[model samples]
Target: MPATTSLQSLHVMVWTALMASLIAVGSFLSIPLGPVPFSMQPLFIMLAGFLLGWPHGMIAVLLFVAAGSIGLPVFAGGKSGLAVLFGPTGGYLIGFVLAAGAIGLLTQARKTARTPSQTPSWALGLLAGLLGLALLYACGLLNLVRVLDIGWNKALTIGFLPFILQDLVKLVMAVATWRIMHGRGLLPR
Candidate 1:
């Protein structure tokens, strides 16, 4: 039984690391659109939570950020180091951590609410994803306002305006992705 438990721990750890790496890959695959880039970071962030749950998913995001802080070049556009964290988009990075944790907690709750044989409710996942996106935008916009010394008007126009639609699409895609993966039993809740 100890061996089984240890093996399970290792399995989850592997998945956690994989999620972190995927986030890094997502950062690289980004399109620069002003202060914030259009990247798949949020998608993978939500997926990490959907699969890993609360602290583990949060840890994965932290690992990704730590890697970039240490000059691993994991941040968007091959950028790295502490400067990126203190830069215009730094708030979004923080958002990623919070959003991942929030999504994981919500999804975990949803899982606990149902039996193993029941199909998990997608509504909760959708709601969780939107909440995660909102956190990201809120953090990102706040940081953008502070870093650029811009008013809410300019910040909202440049930072939030462009992402409104794209972020929603990403949220939907994250839920859909999680549903398909969960259906396949790829990651047990």
Candidate 2:
């Protein structure tokens, strides 16, 4: 029985590692902007939330960030290190953890709705994803303004405007993917 338990623990660790690697790969596919790059991180973040649920999703994101901080070439533009955490993009990077947790909370809350009919719809899932992204941007923009010594207006112009459309598209795709996969009962939990 002890040997069986040890094997199960190893399996879980392997699963977590695989998910972390997925996030690392997702980070590579990015579109460079002025201060922030539009990246596939959010897609995987939402996927982590949907598939692994609350704590695990957040842990997966944390592991990804930790990997990058420790000199792994896992960030956009092939950047890494503690210095990256102090850079303009740091807040946004940190915010990914919160966003995943928030998304997870929203989904889990919906799961406990008193009536089955009262449960959140696919639209709500999309909203949750968008909200998560917005939280990241909120933190990111604030960091950009302070670190770069720019005013709010300039930050909005340079840091915010460029990514809105691309983010919207991503939000839609994340929503659709969640809806389809969940409806088909194919999502990993």
Candidate 3:
């Protein structure tokens, strides 16, 4: 590869690792609420998508999950191993990849539409983040029903309902962070 391409690859690898670490750290800051805990994981996941775009963001999330599945204490409450991947909350864990991809794709689309002088819009960013969260919830709810042997109503109550408001807050925070980073030229265009 050319030197510039090689350097870019190195940059992406480093950011991917950093994002994975952020996800792991986010998992540690959790409030246990039955099977699916409330955590900062979604924030980092959204940030990864916003900053890294789809491919790299998805890679970062998958790496985080792989690390956790391999017995690294990188999951919520420091739980780990393959068992966790197959556990009740596993679907949500897996959903991180999809969520990041969705957010990244949306951001990328917006980015492509803008001129070099124009900045990303906060409303669009928030919409992308909310869509990502919705995808996560969909996966989580389906998995909750299957893993817990619960009905849709119970799954909605246990996994989705309580998280709506908090997730909206997270969505806003993610968008704000993205706006700040982009405004400061901390994020690549």
Candidate 4:
């Protein structure tokens, strides 16, 4: 590979690893609340997508999951191992990859759009973050129903409804952070 290409690859790898670590740290900072704990993971996941773009963001989320599966204390409340993958929150964990991909794609699309003034970047970023949040909740609710043998209503109440407002806040924060980072030219285009 050319030197520039090799250097770019190295840069991507380092960012991916950092994103994975951030996900783990976010999980560690969770507030235990029954089967589903509130964590800062969604914020990092969205940020990963916005800053790293789609492919690298997905890789980072996958790396985070893989580390947790291997018994690393990188999951919510420092829980890990394969058992966590089969637990109630597992679907949401898996959803992180999809969420990141969606957010990254949306943000990338916005970046490539003609007439940038027609649509503010923050609006696109917010939309992407919200979409990602929706996907996460969908996976979480589905898995909650299956894992807990609960009805949809109960799953919604337990997993989705409680976090809506908090997630919206997180979405705003993620968008704001992305805007600042991009504006400062701290993130790769």
Q: Estimate each model's TM-score.
A: 0.96, 0.85, 0.94, 0.93
* TM-score-based ranking: 1, 3, 4, 2
Judging by lDDT against the true structure, name the best candidate. Answer: 1
Residue 149 lDDT in candidate 2: 94
> Per-residue lDDT tens digits of candidate 2, residues 1-189?
999888866765665677678878877898887678878887787777665557777788889999999999898878899888889888888878888777877776676663533434777788788778888788888988989999999988877788778777777776677667666755444
Report the number of the highest-TM-score candidate: 1
Give each model's whole-structure lDDT: 0.89, 0.77, 0.88, 0.86
Per-residue lDDT over 1-189 for candidate 1, one digit per residue giving the tens place of the 0 to 100 score: 999888889998999999999999999989999878888888899888888998899999999999999999999999999999999999999999999999999988778777665655678888898888889889999999999999999999988888778778877888888777777777733
- Cα RMSD (Å) between model 4 and the true structure? 2.2
Q: Report the number of clashing residue pairs per model.
A: 0, 0, 0, 0
- Which lDDT tens digits does candidate 3 get at residues 33-143? 999898999999999999898788888999999999989999999999988888888989878999999999989877878875566898889888888988898888888
What is the Å distance of residue 63 in model 2 from its true position? 0.7
Runs in model 2 lying further than 4 Å from the true structure: 1-15, 114-120
Order by lDDT, highest first: 1, 3, 4, 2
Off by over 4 Å in 1: none
Q: Which ten residues in a row have the lowest lDDT in candidate 2?
A: 111-120
Count clashing pairs, candidate 4. Answer: 0
